[model samples]
Target: MPDPTQPRKDTRGNILFFFGVLILLLLAYHLAKELEILYVSALFAVVLMPVLHRITSWSIRGYHPSRAIAIVLLLLAAALGLILFFTIGLPPVLNDLRGFMTDLPGRIPGAVDRLKHIPLADKLGVETIASRAENTAAALGSYIFTSLPDWLTHVFDILTTIFLCIYFMLEGEHAYEFFLSLFRPPARQRLDATLRKAELKMSKWLLGQGLLMLTLGVCSLTAFGILHVRYFVLLGVLMGLFNIIPVAGGVITIAMAAGVAAIDSWQKMFGVLIFYLIYVNLENAILTPRIMRSSVNLMGLTVLVALLLGTALGGIVGALVAVPTAALISVLLEEYAVQRPSQS
Candidate 1:
């Protein structure tokens, strides 16, 4: 009984709607790319805000907000300068990296040959093990040097990021307040609480994780130095930085260390493995739990979901921020859905 014209109009409307959505999505993507520096700066500012706040407060008795903010900006600038200095000075480090890579494959087989003579290798096979070692070394070399252009791009990106971070540190509070003022008083209060919770969680996570990484790097460098490992400083720093990756960080650290050690000698390779095993257990049992306690306590499933969603949205940066954002969302949802109902 429906008119044919009505159906035709409906189809047209649907097509228009679909196209509109597509256009909007494309626009959003473009805007995000254009403002990438701003977003990254904002993220860094948020992470470091608590440190700035504390320093500001301590120096200026009754929370002289402006002075506190200025101090934070200064600290941020100093940190960025240091990072830039090191990044520029990294050619020698790269040369050492190249040396390590070239030497690794030859060193690994000798170590594997030593392993073949071991009691455990008597039960397993020697040729099979040697083949596996070769394959692993090849894969590692490929992984290390496959994307030179991408590395250069990332380095350039870091300079822009530093500038953005300074800008955000300076203007963050005003921007936050402006956004917060958009809602009704009660809604604003709720929003403020949510923001505070997220900021606190993120700040604690950043500070604690930063300290943890520094400690881990120091420990790794010292241990590797004692073991006479090649490129110990470089490897230690890489491991420490990558340790932020969640769950798989420790495994990757051990794998990289082991691969490098395999190039040195069998005894060194064995020593690296043993060191990692002990280190990992110690980290898990002592350090991680302590560091992570103040941060958002996300479920494993939530973390995986966040990671996937983040990667889909923004690659590495997305993956880095996704877990914390998801945790904040969970907290907000719980506050509204469960807590509010109980209160009523």
Candidate 2:
């Protein structure tokens, strides 16, 4: 019943379609940065959807808040948290910082003098090392001044992402519909289900990551306080905040803590190192698996690869989204690409 005149397939049309897709891929590569911003904004909106839904579901005398109202409430809550931190948690740290800066010059000489007592300390050229440290600090100040414009650009990008995220949350459904319309109904439904699964897993990631950060912060505060480490408050806060950055964050903060401890005594420095080593072991062996595994179900190797690739491609923003993006990709692969025993 095949018609010879019609031909078996539209070969010309297929070739044109292939070329069109290739052009799109090239264009996407050229504008990857802008695409990344939009993708990140969309990902954030997806992750926050659960919280937004929860807020909208609350009925105040049968008057449920709209998505826009819910988003505003969430923003207000974040602002309140920042205000509280600045008011209550920051003052003691600021006071300690001021005192530390005032005493740094006096303390450095003593630290260097103490170093002289160690065997081969003079051979190591402690004074030279001290001078190098001072030079490094001056260079850091210069770098900060030079990077002001870059920092401003980053702030603008952040603001753009925030506004885009809000817009997505408010009107994402329409966009979603349009996106799905590109596919046949069967494929569209399957994708919708797969993405829903991914979203649930991604939301759980946020909760698990938050718990891990808080636990580390509390533990750092207690241990540093007991060890009488200098600027324990500030160090603890830094440890918690920097935990968001994965391996690099922990290493940097712990090294900083050890350096501060060393400024006091070798024993304190050893204590800081030992504490960090133990904490890292516990976090890796116990905490990460029990918390993150249940949330994302990703293997250690996969997560590590994702983090490396993300950080390489997008820096902090890439790293921030790496695990969740991996989760999403994993789900899609399982649905469409993976070969199950039954399918085999």
Alpha-carbon lDDT, every model:
0.75, 0.87
Q: What is the C-alpha lDDT profile of model 1 across 71-157, one tens digit per residue? A: 566767887977985886366467767777677666766766667767878678777877787778667777766776678887767
Q: What is the lDDT of candidate 1?
A: 0.75
Model 1 lDDT, residue 245, Cα? 59
Cα RMSD to the true fold for all candidates:
5.9, 3.1
What is the per-residue lDDT of model 2 for residues 246-317, given as tens digits with 9 covering 90 to 100? 677788899999888988999999999999999999998999999988778988788789889999999988
Show model 2 residue runs off by greater than 4 Å. 1-9, 91-131, 284-286
What is the lDDT, from 0 to 100, of the residue 278 in candidate 2? 98
